[model samples]
Target: MTSILIADPIPLLNKGEQALLEGIVESLNIIFSKPDIMLLSNYPEKDARRSRIPVINRNPVLFKSIKKIMPRSAFLLEGALMAILARFGKQNFRRLFTRSELWQAFLNSDIIVVGHDSSVSYDAVIIGWLLNKPLVIFAGSIELFRNKLKESIAKVLLKKVNLITLREDDSYKALMDLGVIPGVKTQVTADAAFLLKPCSPERVKEITQQEDLPVHDRPKVGVTLTRQMCERSHQEINDVNERYKKAIAEKAIVLDEIIERYNVEIVFFPHCIGPGKNDDRLVARDVIQLMKRKDMVKPVVSDLGASELKGLIGQQCEVFIGERTHSVIAAMSQGIPSICITFPSDRRTHGIIGGMICQRDFIYNVERLNPIELLTLVDKLWAERPVIRKKLEGIIPLVKERALNSARLIQTIVSEKEKSDNGYRCPSSQH
Candidate 1:
């Protein structure tokens, strides 16, 4: 059996990340016959419970435990010492520290796939490179690094990857700017989340009824928000918090106008619930508290999975105003018109919504958020919703095809590797 190790520390709380993981897994299942898959996780026990696939900690258990009590300098020293031991220690010495399991998993896997955009995935890429494992970065959105050191490191790491499938044209262009050319090694694809299947209509209805979301009584307008809108700004800590409060207040005003003018129920989808201040639920609560019409607004606080949440958005919403990329993608995939609220430097929005979906005009930068402008755009979307929906229907299939193309490319890489290793060709190649 072919073994594949996914080096993403899957955060189950964030629905967007969960959607990416599920879509990638679903796509892989179509290409490989029950491939033995393992995941490296920060919350290994929780992730193991959530997913059927085996999960392992990114670091050894003892080191992780020791990290809590050790001082920062000591911890760094210990980490360096452990690395040397793992690399050069005698077999029994390494076995004594339980370093074998982590190293063995990396050594045994045929390929390592990175599905996240964070530093955790970059660390995995470095390790996989050192081990000489086939590496594929799937559906990533790469942006130009503002830091020279980071840019240099990214250039080095990305240049060596077997395949790098980007989710947006901006990312592909960014790679080009960094001298990573578009060839056999690099290609543009759509986000993996586009292939994630939503829950059934029956399930969506059940969720609506369970959450008391008045989806049946009125036209529902789905909205998503995140704290990053303020945090990502080039401001000091104090300024960021103050700006966040102002942004939330402005959003409340916008939602109030949207509700009164359009006679629609505002459903707040907290796409990322939290590990910290990044929680959308807290932001939604603040927005709700500041709004005049609390009865017209409902925040989804239930623990719905990514697909289930996508089902609710796609099935119940007439129009979506989303800050989360995946939430907007969900609405778009189902032919629902959406306005994307994005951070100033978020290339994913510019690339996907602007370039692929052809809805560049609907994207609003949160840093320069104007209620009047947003309301005008919302009015336009409401007026032309039928046309917008029709346009999306025609466009979504092609985007989905592009999304699935990443999976086909993965299959090709795996098949070619297998053929070279075993001197046997794949059945698909026979045709």
Candidate 2:
């Protein structure tokens, strides 16, 4: 069997990350002949319970404690030392330095795959490179590093990667700016979530009833919120809390106006539940609590899986106004018209929504957020939804094919590795 390791630690609480992992796993299963797969997850026990595949904690307790104390430079230096020890030390020392099970999985794996959605991490890349493992980064939207140390590190580590399939043009451009050579090693692909299959209609209905979403005759407008959406950059604000509350209040007023003007039910999709204050559920609650038309608003408070959430949105929503990138992607994939609420730092919205899907008009900047402007955009989106939906129907299939192509590219990398290593044999074939 070809043992494959996904290096990123997926947290099920973040449905976008879950969607990426699910799509990648589904694609890999279809591409490979029952390949042995394992996940490195943040919530390993929970993920293991949900998935048939073996799950290991990406950050073990000891490592987590160590990272908390160590400065980033010191931490990275320690990782380098450990990698070197793992590469050249005695068996016992290697086991000690590599941190047991995590490194053991790294050593046993034929290929190391990193799924980068909104952000990029270089931990897996560094270790995988040191171990001489074939590494592929798929469906990534890599941002240009503002910090020089991170930029330098990215340049050094990324060059060693076997393949890098970016999800957006901005990421590709960022890679070029970082001086990573493109073409075969780097290619732009659509997000893996684009290929994620929604749950059955029956399951969707079950989730709808379970969440106690309104079953009224009015058209439903799906909305996704995040704490970040109500935040401005620290440079722009003195009192963050005050500004956030003000933003929430402003949003509440706008949503109330939207309800009254359009006679639409606003369904808040909690795209990310929590790890902290970043929870969409909390943000939605804050907005809903301040709104006058509470009866017209419903928040999906249940911690549902990515496919289930996608199904609910696809079946129920006529228009989506989403702060979460994947929520917008999910809605757009289903041929539903969506307005993307984007932060200044978010490259994904412009690159994916504007560049790929050609819906630049519907993307609104959160920094310069105006309630009247947002309401106007919503009105325009509502009016032009049919045409937008039609455009998406024409474009989404091609984008989905690109998403599937990422998996095919992985197969090619694996095939090339097999060809180059004559002494290596599949464990299943050996048996």
What are the candidates' C-alpha RMSDs? 4.9, 3.2
lDDT of 2 at 230: 78
Give per-residue CA lDDT, model 2, range 195-264, as digits (tens): 8899999998888889899888889989998887777623377788877888899889988998899889
Candidate 2, superposed: residue stretches over 4 Å from native: 46-52, 60-99, 233-237, 422-431
lDDT of 1 by residue, 1-431 (tens): 67788875777778888788888888778777888788877777766755657887665444555666664343234434444454566655555444445555665677788644432266666666655567888888776688999899878878767888888877777778888775438888888888888999999889988998884578999999888874543354367778787778888999999989999999989888778887888989999999999999998988788899899998779999998888898889889999998865777777888889999988887766778888999999999999999999999999988988887888888888776652111122221
The TM-score obtained by model 1 is: 0.87
Candidate 1: worst 10 consecutive residues by lDDT?
A: 422-431
Report the lDDT of model 2 for residue 123. 75
Clashes (N, CA, C under 3 Å) per candidate = 0, 1
- The C-alpha lDDT values of all candidates are 0.78, 0.81
